[model samples]
Target chain A: MSERVSRTTFYKRLSRLWRNGDSRPLLMQALVVLVVLLLVVWVINNTMNNLEHRGISTGFDFLSQEAGFGIIQTLVEYDESHSYGRTFTVGVLNTLLVSSLGIAFATVLGFLVGIARLSANWLLARAASVFIETFRNIPLLLQIFFWYFAVLAALPHPRRSLAFGDMIFLNLRGLYLPQPVIEQGLMPVLASVVVAIVTALVVRATIRQHRLRTGQGTIAMPWLLLGVLVGMPALVWHFSGATLSVELPQLRGFNFRGGITIIPELGALLLALTIYTAAFIAEVVRAGIESVPKGQKEAAAALGLKPGKVMTLVVIPQAMKVIIPPLTNQYLNLAKNSSLATAIGYPDLVSVFAGTTLNQTGQAVEVIAMTMAVYLTISLSVSLLMNIYNRRVALIER
Target chain B: MSDQMIPARKPPKQSVGLLVWSKNNLFASLPSTVATVLIVYGLYLLLPPVVQWGLLDATWWGSDGTACTTEGACWAFVTARLDQFIYGFYPQDHQWRANVFFFQLVLLIGWLTIKATPGKKWVLGYALLLMPLVSWWLLYGGLGLKIVATHQWGGLMLTLLLALCGMVASLPFGILLALGRRSNMPVIRALSTAYIEMWRGVPLITVLFMASVMLPLFVPEQVVFDKLLRALIGIVMFQAAYMAEVVRGGLQAIPKGQFEAFGSLGLSYWQGMVLIILPQAMKLVIPGVVNTFIALFKDTSLVLVIGLFDLLAIVQAGLNDPAWLGFAVEGYLFAGFVFWAFCYGMSKYSQRLEQQLHQGR
Candidate 1:
């Protein structure tokens, strides 16, 4: 009888523990935490053992060592004597250069094609659809290869280069355009431009306040702002003795000299990234514009608004809410896809820092970790900025 | 009034039929007419040369570079090296194994597509469980079959295998991660979130590099990773994060009432998810899964950067051949066409599936 009473009491205690408020969940969570910690510990321990056995000491100190390889393209000052750390910065800047240019060109082209797809003209709409489908469906790598090897490489030599008057030249080497040489006085001109911008902003704000108070729209303020922005820069350039000159490319020996040279690698990467991404962006833009209700367009038209005004006032603003999120995603994708430059020897982050540096130093862990961190930082920053903009544009309900 | 009405009899010949349609569509405004003219002129300048190069003046059959006598595309190179392009360095005799594997895949797809297939759940479960093993046997060779190394594997075969295995392996892990992310347990949520974000934040190339170069250093000294296996691991990890996001989107779409209903039935957490929630969630996410698969298919091309002989890599190899040095254009175009066809077809199918599934909602 005593044994049975003890068993019953034990069971009662067990049941009480199970029924305790939130303790079961807490226990389960703790168990999960324990398992995760153990797994991480195991992996790290194994890695350490492996590294020790392989005689590869893992640390980030190698970043300060000299990198002895030449990069084809460098956005900042870099050479073979520079440390790996500087090479990393150079790689990152090159990546940024390609991504930013690609984004700008892709956006402009994408918007044009997107609007064309909705054209009343049947041929224009069909052409836009064909363009989107043709470029997007092909693998971007193949497109890059085509641009690099088939099209650009097949260009004539510098002596017989294709030229547009005296301004631009294209050949097997690259596209050469006149380089703008800004003289010393250009600094003051640039400063005046900044001042004009600030003044214009203040003037615009005051005009907005005046219009809000008096119920009269100040239309001339926009022209005044534009005038200040353009006129100020021109006047300063003229009076401040800023001498701006264009140095045209001259064929020298085997290559062009004096002008800005766009290497074939950059041209191929830029063109492929722009054309490929533009197709997807076009689709996003089309979907955004279509998502706006037909009733809204009709309502705007009924309000005596011109077709262009209706598009600007009613369609675009509403469509942007749907467009911006996907647009940001496309931008991120283009940035990531720029890493494909390694395949074509574009000296991107992965190619220069991760590929060549890792190979030379045999410090795979440190090189890869740093490269991944750079990308992660970029991705997160882009997301945070876009999210803030998205929130601002999002419709709020009372 | 009758006389005025009698005058309105017949419309002009140009104001009817195709002419009228063209007038409304192509010549409605000055801008439209100008755009039409420019587009037509552009096509006029572009289409014939492409057609002549691709079809008319192209060499249809030859064995060497010398066979391409004309200025048109050297399709002869693609034809001559077609076997290498398709199978990479796989032994010609063992190419039959790849064919059999493809056939099995087709059969499985056919069975899945047929609406009236009986015992579908059991068949699908069995196939899902057994297909990987069967494929491994067919690919790597075992049990009286000649042993074929992964390095010998390349071309479309390797691309398909990598994508299929990655998609299959990632799906369950993605589901678990997605569940953990939404779980009440804080530790599990944090772990899942970190894993997803870390993988998603980095480019697949970096992940590939880590797997190819660093994975060896992570494992025990005696253990070695095959190049294909390393690339596969990277691909699976990268894809799982994307898959988890898609699955999470599906999970968030499910109503909270379903969870409560499962709770009222005295179901455990796993039981509720498995029986009540996941089925609806998975159904809603079929399109997303297919889209991810398409992306994975395209990404398999990146294996070339890691020195894997995928389809793109094989084509590149062919381009490097001394005999076919200048025929890169044709080889790349052929490979591009193949990839485009597959990706485009799957995307279209996904759209159809999405539309069908959407109607049920």
Candidate 2:
């Protein structure tokens, strides 16, 4: 193996590797690599020179330094005394909170509107199209401003909030909801809830196996599920003796206190992100549904399935194969758009970490790189999961 | 029986009459009926108030917000600052230059978008070469014209410029990236894939932040970029990743046979891509390309984060003025409407183009 080939044979092997001398892709690739390496080095050298020129020390050490700034909508335990690392965690949590909430609401609303657009009823379909067109065309930033400054800011102050049966209140400050308080012994209840879920899943899987193997439906399946899912949790709560109370926010001095508050920054960001993204999701869903052949629906109907059953069983499963890829894209988009929360002081990753921390520390390279890395991880991970799903569902050819 | 003359008597009342149509469509079932009623009620609540606020009670001629206030939108504010929103601080005398450039662009776009227009080759050359020169001369005003600095350009003018430049500049680079991603060379392929993914993974805001703040550090100390140019660079780089994907879709749809055919015709890879493969692939991807352009156009609003006063930022600037402090709603609505109109119009054209191309294929 260590022996070298003869010169004539070596040249012959090289000619074969070069694809009969058509062109030199290897040469081209080498050139590209050299250019890229040179570019990266030049950039680094210039950056070092500039950093020295500006007297700005750069490192990730700034992340451990005192943040000394406050974020209005932190999800984690945080204060002015926390480190920039904690601020980063808080910003990530807030971004995830808004993104997950937006995803949930947009999925529900988008599906409904998508179905409405397909409805036989002319009015509903027209209304759905109008909803899509109006929201889809407007810039999200403008919509964010409209919701934050125009609508929410115009609400009355805490002293004269629009009370909702006195259990909820809307004011310029934010939406105040009744907070559910559970004091002591909640661990048992939570454990029972998890147990109930596990038991339900086990029962379902067993029933499905029995039916598949023995070819018989379990008549008491619904009752068994209900008993496990509902009865178990209720019994655990009774035995645990946990006390629960609902506390409505009350006006304290000039501001409201003691309830779960959804600040207007979050409200506006969530609303804009949800509404804007839902429009795209609606289009994706509509296209997905339309992609299902009409013959499938007709064939299912001919087999005596009702329209609803036909849709649920036959159309939806097929439509999902079309929907998941674009739906994943929209999810990625919403996550990225959550950064727009910076516009309204929503304390997202970009706003708190990149905007505020970078300003204070003047570690532009580190701060911005960290921010981009977080988003990149999110987008790449989601797309990777979607790729696996796509591969699983892709049509297999002979 | 064969003639079936009885069928011609009249279609059943269940299918033919207006009442039947309404019953079938508007009151088809319980949920639909409820939806119809709720929707009508919603329209009743929303439409009249919207019309009344927008038109009936709006103050259209006032010079300031304090003039002739009513319980409706102050269109007067928009009208008073309309020129500012359109021209920004571009010198009042030099405003005609901006107008001429806009008209030239409008003509170019119409020529490109209209179906089967003649002189396509000439239009391509003009768009590729001449228009950029004319625009720079007309807007930047250095050739026998008074120089208008970039900061003086803002509002809708800057918005269009950013979108157009981003679209034009990224397109060829996007094509190259797409080709490189599909290249047989492993190193080039890996590098292109990494470059595309790196941009696509991050949000545009981060890209803009890096461009505006950290970009100067990556260049020599003597070099400086105007804020608008930095923002444009960010937009182009961010947009190219998406554009590459679209073009890749087009390229992928071209079968391997075409590549083999080009090769058999004694064409090198670059020659084949440029002379044969690209034209056909580009035709397939027009609508997809247009869709990305709409995205880039809407994304132009993001420049405001970097302190560039594009259309939305101009409105924001106006709203910040002491005289117009309370008209955030009016300012945002106007800016929203303008953005919506452009986006909606482009999207509709793209959709129609897709249908037309699909039918042709």
Candidate 3:
């Protein structure tokens, strides 16, 4: 009897613990933790053993060593003498430069083409659809190759460069444009414009309060605001002796000099990235626009708003609410895809730090970790910002 | 309304005429008319020269670049290297093995895709299990067949192999990760989320770099994987994260009632998942899975970074050949067309599947 009672109690306790929500979940979680810990430990052990056997020292100190590499194009001051750390900075800035440019161009083109897809004109809509289908279906890497090796490489040599109105030049090497060199005096003029903007904002806030106190005063004094915005900047510029001059690219040696030089690699990468990403963005934009019910547009028009205003004030705002979440994804993809620059030797972060540095130092672990970390930080921050915007948009609907 | 539903009479001939249709569609307004004219003018200026260069003035039936005597495209390079582009460096004598492998794939894929075909279970089993073994035995070769190293594989064959293998290997992993992500256990969910986000945050280039560079270091010295296998592993790891998110979307849509019903039937978690939950979730996510497959197909081109000569890489290499030098335009056009055709076909099929699934729902 005693044995039976003890067995029953033990079984009862075990079954109760298993059936309970809290204990079972906790036990499952603990088991998962244990398994993961074991796997991580095993991996670490193997890694340590392998590293030791291969005789590859791992540390971030390699960053301070000289890179001894010549990046063809850099957004920052970079040379063979620069440290690996400086190469990293240059790589990051170049990546950002291309990504931002690609984003701006893709957005503008995508919106135009996306809106065109819905045009009443049959030919225009078909053209837009054809573009989206063609670019979207092909891989971006192949497009990059087509642009670089096929199209750009086929351009005439620098001696017979195609010149546009004596300010822009295109050749096998790159596209060159006259850069604006601002004089030292331009600083005060820029400062004065900033002051004028602040003054205008202050004036508007005071006017809003004034209107609240007295019904006679209107809140928007367009004339006064316009004068503050434009006249102040103009007057300051006239007095500040600010001079801006164009620095035209001149044929020097084998290449252009003294102007903004877009290396062929960057150009091809930008063109391919913009065209490829724009196709997807266009689809997203079209879907967002289509998601806006026709009844809403009809209602807006019924209120006597013009078609343009209906789009700007009513339809676009609603469409944006749907467009942005997907737009964030596209932006993230573009940023990540920018790493493909390595294939074309565009000196991106991966090419410079992860490729050159890792090869020179043979520090695969440190270099790859840092590269992955930079991307992780970028992706996380971008997604975080977009999420906040998404929340605000969602909140506005209520 | 007539009781017999008076046969919908054909509208007046004037209304149905092409002139009226064109008026509404192409010239509905001044801007529309202008747009029509502008597009027509643009096409007029562009189409003829493109057509001439690509077709009329192009050289064909040539063995080398020198045979091209025209001022237009020299398609001779593509013609001469067509076998290389299709089969890579696979030995010419045994090229029929590759053909046989492709035929098997066609039959198996046809069985799944034709809709009227039966034995979905058997087909899936053969594809997921037996197909890989057969492909390896045939392509890599052993067991009474001469051994062919993976390095010899290149061209469109490699591209398709990488994509198919990546999709097949990553699918089960993606499902597991999705399940882990939606698990009630915090550790599992957190780990799944971290794994997915880590992979998603980086580019495939970096992942390939890791696979080619660091993966060997993580394993024992004697356990070295082949270069192609390493690249495939990287691809699977990268693609599985995307697949997980797609599957998770399907899992999230599954109602709580299904869970409760499965539990009430005295089913365990795995049993419920395999029988009740996964079947519906997988059906719901078939379109998404296909989209991922399309993406993977395009991404296989990136294996060039790791020194694998996929179709794009093969074309790129062909560009540098002294005999075929300066024919970059023809080389790229052929490769681009092939990629475009495959991707477009898959995307269209995916759209049709999505619509059919939606209609069923």
Candidate 4:
């Protein structure tokens, strides 16, 4: 009788398991997990065997070995005697330099073009449209080629460099500008600049709070902030005995000898990234501006707000909601597109670590994995930062 | 009273015509006038030279590089290498195969574009399933035809082939991924999410590198993948992740009531999805799909990094040739123009499709 009862209970439990919603999905998931695991295991096994047969070690020990190649451009001190790890860092820094510069230039250009596209003047609008269409339609790689092979390469040699005043030169090699030499007292100037920025932020916050509480606006904050930021730095530099010296680029054998030089590869990559991304950003900016309802502008004007105040308080704030998302995307794309510097031998992460290092070490898997991880980390961090900003700008409704 | 009406006076001078229009639009404020004058001056300084260089002084036709002696654009170089630019090193005599394939492609695309095409389902099936095979056979040459190595395929032909194949191959995978991501099963969703995010997060260059270098290690020792095939696989994988996100957006737009309606009919999950859900969802996201295609089209140039002689690569190669020295400008301009034309055309078409679909809905 006890055995019969146990059998009945077992059957009931089995039926319940089969009939439950959660159990079905759990079973299906388990099967899927098993299949995926099997595939991964097979691939790993194959990779191990292949590596063994090919006599290529699968670890990342080669990163510590010397890199015997010279990079044309580097943000940090690097030489052939440096390790592959140093090469990787140089590549990452170069990429960051180009991408950051590209972002800054593109944002300015994009905003200009975007506003011009909506200009009251027909000629201005048409010109902006033409610019957008021309840049947007062409592939970025081709544009890079245009700048590198055609434009920069076609420039005359250093002996015949194009001079802008006494301090700047452009030639086949690169743009050369006078390098600034800061003297001992420059720390005071730098400190004052930092202090000015913090003071500006505090002042702006106070003004915002005062306006919110009293419904009265103070317009002096921006001018005051600008004065503190620029005036204080200038005063410190002038009176604190901080001597600024310029080291002009001297023409040497075949190239300029001493000064800051922007290599053609970096120049071309920056130009292409800026122009191409600016075209897309212009569209985003245009769309965002257009997305703001006409009523918002009218309502602000009806409230007796000044033209600038109407734009700042009503139109731009609303437009930010639409613009921030797409703007973030463009910034991310600029970062990713900077990888194309590889094609032009720009010594970017992909070119240095993935291309040269991998070729030297024959550690394809490890090199590629590392390069990919760097990009993934950059992408994730950018998105996280942008998401926080987006949340603040997002419309709040009760 | 009509007879006594005063003769119609000329409209107040500043109320109409060019003067008023300019005043109202261009010179309305100090800033506006400044912007107008600056832009006009910039255009005046820029436009004439570009026109002269691009049109008036440009060389049109020549047999070789000598015909392009002038400083202006050497269209002659473009003319000299036009065939190579279109067909790459695709054999001189077998170029007809590519021509025929392109012709077939045009017809298929034309048919697909027509709103009232008869037997739409069957036509779509034929175009999607059979056309790729036939085109592949023709282009690659197998079974009774002379086989053309994929390495020989370059230029515009290679570009189109990569873009089309990537788009076609990615669609199914992307759809499945999108579905899996939205599935109730935890493991499938996690896997799909991981795959999609990883692909989307990294640049396509790294992906291509992995495919070119590391893929061989992942497969068995005996297995071989052609260079083009490996690049294509990488592109397909990378694009599919983006396509999945786009498809997921479409899926989310579908109302829950549609699922309920399917359930009311006692339809299975797959049946409901295949028949009702996906059709509506895909229809909604046609513009997104086309945009992805445009992006893929542009991205095919990256294959050059993997040593594929695509159109841009061919241009670079031509520039390197001693015969075509100092003609990088013309070659690059030509390549850029071609890419621009194709991308711009596709974008306009997508915009039109979006408008039409919006109206239909």
Candidate 5:
């Protein structure tokens, strides 16, 4: 009985020490929590009071109202008579359009510039360096403004437009190019094209299998090209009396007619976004390519690969592992920066939905919420896609 | 022993002349030589026009476009509007107040950044708390000098003020948020996460729009903040999110051993952070912080969208002036050069800091 009582006393002392041992840190933590909660509460109270005093109803019911703005270069059909929701759809599509074009052009230019920077030719390397430094240092918005207000705006009017070909022209008004119209029996031609692609893949797989079974193989590229390229066109021509034709842009009074027109606004925005972002992308690409060791090329050369083959087969594949993450970052930045197009009155996502629709509906909360949600989704998805790509290319070790 | 056997060193070879250097570097092969010539020609075609238009044929001394109707660039628009570009519509007589405030700010920043500030910690505290108050008095001038309203402030002055104030306010808030993100308590972490994600997910333009239009509705009726101040707050809040992310990166880079060491020494978490974690983390991330500052400086141009006449906005305004019609190129080029200089200088300085950190390591 005495031993049991001693054990209980020991347990009681241990509990007492544990309670007060970490008390000070816990108290400081509690104080922090208290301050945060109190501040939040105060702000919310103030906001509600402010809203009530201003008589502004803070709800999101206005999204269904008619939006009175038109967006340029929308992927989907849209009209000013549509609801704000539809306008937002158009805006998002336009944003995606510019961003995708910017990404594609910037990637190609960036790779070329990056390679040129590492060139053996002295003048070419210096030129690339000058390009990178000059473009990257300037503000992107200023470049956009310069292109819009200075360069593109100074082009000759439609009557005196610069002609590229019988079918194409460049002018202050817009770029005019022939638009393709689907002829009868086009679906069968498209089906044949798809079939050709599938057959090429099958042939490629069979070749791979044969090479593995017996260490002898033949080049499949010529056959694959013939199947996909020549086969489809031939089939299309035979099946549908479908003939390719160009509708030349003709000047009618003040404007050009008889072709699809790309406005100067879109042209300026695309040019500025591509050129400005390409400078940054070029740097990222250069860093990524440089991060791959010279020994990689040496190894490929030592294995009897030609220089061009070594670059394509060995050097680039490794460099891509380094290139993709920062490339995704540049793409995201381009998408975000496209919002600056609103400054130039380009009917982009921000201008259509955020500027005009917000003004009409006065649903500041809902409109802003939608706008932010779209960008966030774009940024998040691009990052997510890159993460997947990164995992695919990442080095695997035991 | 060494004199018995020695390796002979030959004189440098004849394959080291300028011609050889040119061959190796520029004309390593036939294709490279062609590439060099083509690039030189391209530069030749591009550079001369720019030089002629921007320098040789440029009009430097004039106040209007009529004085520069020659076959040259009329740069007079920029010069004529230089005052508006720098000080906006701030009353001309009281421009000295803004100048004084800017001077004091520079001094304060210099004092804080230097190594030999007497009583370093307390002086820094004073600098942090006092500079803003003194500058405010100098700017607002309610106590003594003539009062200049916020709306009258524009151009580079407004841009600098907004950025400086935003940075000053955001730093402490950013630190707190960063600490909260790493806090042991679930509530604190969640709160910080929500705060950071909310601000970060939205673009700065939308935030500015909210501050200008929606914020008024959130405050009590008739309790109006200056439009510029509202924009300033938006900038601070948005920047704080980015700053928090940067600080969090720095915090994550700190080794766990440092934390454990402090804990082993019977230090509280706050004590550990103040004494051990921050100094090391900050040193590791100085370059990143400066890059953020550069980005923030560029982003200040967005205020133009909200109808504030910043440097870019003033230039845009100048472009539309009837007297300066068709001179948008000159105006934009001037603005671009200014922005380029500022950003490039900061980026170079950051690079230097990065080099110093490498040396330290």
Candidate 6:
């Protein structure tokens, strides 16, 4: 085939290309792309050269050094002596704590408000509208400040803290609540939970198998609960002492000394974020609920299902498909907005890594890079989780 | 039966006009009647104090903080510090030049926005060139105006400058980013994704911190960048990612027919995008664009975190003035009202634009 190839054939193709008259546009396009590419390369090269001249070493090496900063709220034990990597973990955990709490609280409030917005009761609908408008219109940072400086700061001193029963205390600092202490015998209770879960799984499988094989099935929930509550607890109690204690918070010299103290900074940040995000989430929830056809509710009712069950099983399940994507957006928003915590001295990820670290180390490039990486990782993980849920809820068909 | 049917008539009216309307709308049921009563009473309780504080008890004209000691809004503090708030530490006499610069900028912007104006392209080009030059002269005062450095820039002037500059700089960058995201080439798409996600994932405060602190360290040891310029850069970079995503949503909503028609018409992608697709997409996204603008306006308040005195910062600074001590609530309320007005107007305008566009469609 190579031997048979002729100069005329190649020339014909080349001539045909010129004759086709598409070359001019193609050349223009190519030139435009080339110029743009050259400009980008020039900029990048200049930046790199600038960095080199300045003696600024760029990379991930600084992550191994001592952080030299204290985080306020940490899940894992941490101190100023910890490595930057560990400090970063602390920051990440604090971020997760706020976002998760915000998500849970926002979802509950959002659903209530959203349903209220669509309620037949005029007062309920107006109240929901008022809540959405008032909260959503104000800037979240301002709300955080309001909560921190105005509301929380106005609370009485610890000695005269607002008493919420015998187990909890409230002051300018935050809500202080009792912490439960698990005793040695609690192992049996935990073991029972594990047994219960396993038994439930086994029962579920058996019921499905029986339904398929012989059109017969038994409710497995009671048996599973009995197995866990009776079997595991009895076995564990015989082996060890089982006891429990609750330590109630009490006002001391200037602050609560025992139990868990939710600092005002955390409270303010969480409250602002949850309330602000809940407004948007309420709109999302309202839209989701309204998107469900009336016929579905009617059909459920026709099947002899109670109104509450109809909502729990049929309406919510379908509405969730609509709810989840926007809910994910709101989740991301809450996470990002939590950075406002820095304004009030909540030592979140941004405050610790981006704010304090940059101040101390003066390694702006590396510290900023590290901060961005942390946020990016969190955002991506949240997106990934939501996407998986989205896939599961999506309709499947041949 | 026919006589009975003929005798059937409308029910007698028990009420008329507002009474009937109120009965139907405000007091439709027992609970609604209670809500109506409570709401009216609540309004009566809340509004009079607000009116008194804002208007009746306010000090309108004063030279200093001494004029605002009463249990009312410290308008005199705002008026006395108005210059400080508007131009920050910028020189006093040169403020007139800034005012002139602002008026000219507004005139030019108005010219561009008005459809009847000819030479749209040339006016746009001039605007693109003149804004930076005039603002530089107005702010830095190098070209015969009087050089006032960025440190002196604060208050409404600072806010307006940041919003305008950030919005303008972000537009082109965001458009490119959006195009890159939608590009057919995998490498280009990946690069765009990385850039957008990196910026979008983090909060603007982090970015600002980087700009103010890390950026100098990244460049060189002794090379100093202007703090205001750095903040502006941070604002632009952070906002561009969000703007790109918004633009991308609009881009995606354009139907395949539009693309195919452009293709069949032998139009290049850039040509089609610029001349046809973008206009339609942008019109469709007017509400989203306006919402983003409102968001950007609110976000300008965050500049306080980095020590720049925007409106909120100025109010915060006012709270510390010995005469106005313990007036944080009043200061914040004033600032909040101003912000609310601007944002509310933008939102309302967007809603109107949505209706306008819908009708046009």
Give lDDT: candidate 1, residue A27.
64
Clashing pairs in 4: none
All candidates: CA RMSD in angstroms? 2.9, 3.9, 4.0, 3.1, 5.3, 5.8
Q: Encode model 1's per-residue lDDT on B1-361: one tens digit a residue.
A: 4655455757678777998999999999999999999999999999999999999989978878888899788898888887887788899999999999888887887786677877777767756577878898998998989999999998888888998899988998999999989987788899899899889888898899999998887767678889999999999999999999999999999999999999999998889999999999998998899899988898899999889998988998888888777887888799999998988887887898899997987
Q: Quick one: ranking by lDDT, best first?
A: 3, 4, 2, 1, 5, 6
Best by DockQ: 2
What's the best-to-worst order under DockQ? 2, 4, 1, 3, 5, 6
User: What DockQ does candidate 5 score?
Assistant: 0.50
True contacts kept of 5: 0.62
Off by over 4 Å in 3: A1-21, A196-231, B1-14
Report the C-alpha lDDT of model 2 over A1-398, residue by residue, as the tens digit.
43455777888877786775545677567778899999999999999999988899977887788999888987778999999999889989999999999999999999989988999999999999989999999888889989998899999988999999988999999999999887677878888999999999988998988888898996247788988899998998997787778888998898889889999999999999999999999999999999999999999999999988898889999899899899989999999999989988999999999999889989899888889999999998988898888787874411
What TM-score quantifies how close candidate 6 is to the native fold?
0.82
Q: Compared with the true structure, what per-residue lDDT tens digits does model 4 show for residues B222-259?
A: 99999999999999999999999999999999999999
Q: Which whole-number lDDT from 0 to 100 does residue A23 have in model 5? A: 60
Highest lDDT scorer: 3
Off by over 4 Å in 5: A1-60, A69-74, A205-230, A233-240, A388-398, B1-14, B101-130
TM-score of each: 0.95, 0.95, 0.93, 0.94, 0.89, 0.82
Docking band of candidate 6: acceptable
Q: Best TM-score goes to which candidate?
A: 2
RMSD of 6: 5.8
Residue A233: error of model 5 in Å?
4.3
- Which pairs clash in the backbone of model 2? none
lDDT of 5 by residue, A271-294 (tens): 999998888888888898789899
Superposed by TM-score, candidate 3 places the C-alpha of residue B275 at a distance from the truth, in angstroms, of 1.2
Tens digit of lDDT per residue, candidate 5, span B73-166? 8878888888888888988888887788778767765675565777766766765577667777777778767778877888878877777778
The CAPRI class of candidate 4 is medium
What C-alpha lDDT do the candidate models reach, one value each? 0.89, 0.90, 0.91, 0.90, 0.82, 0.79
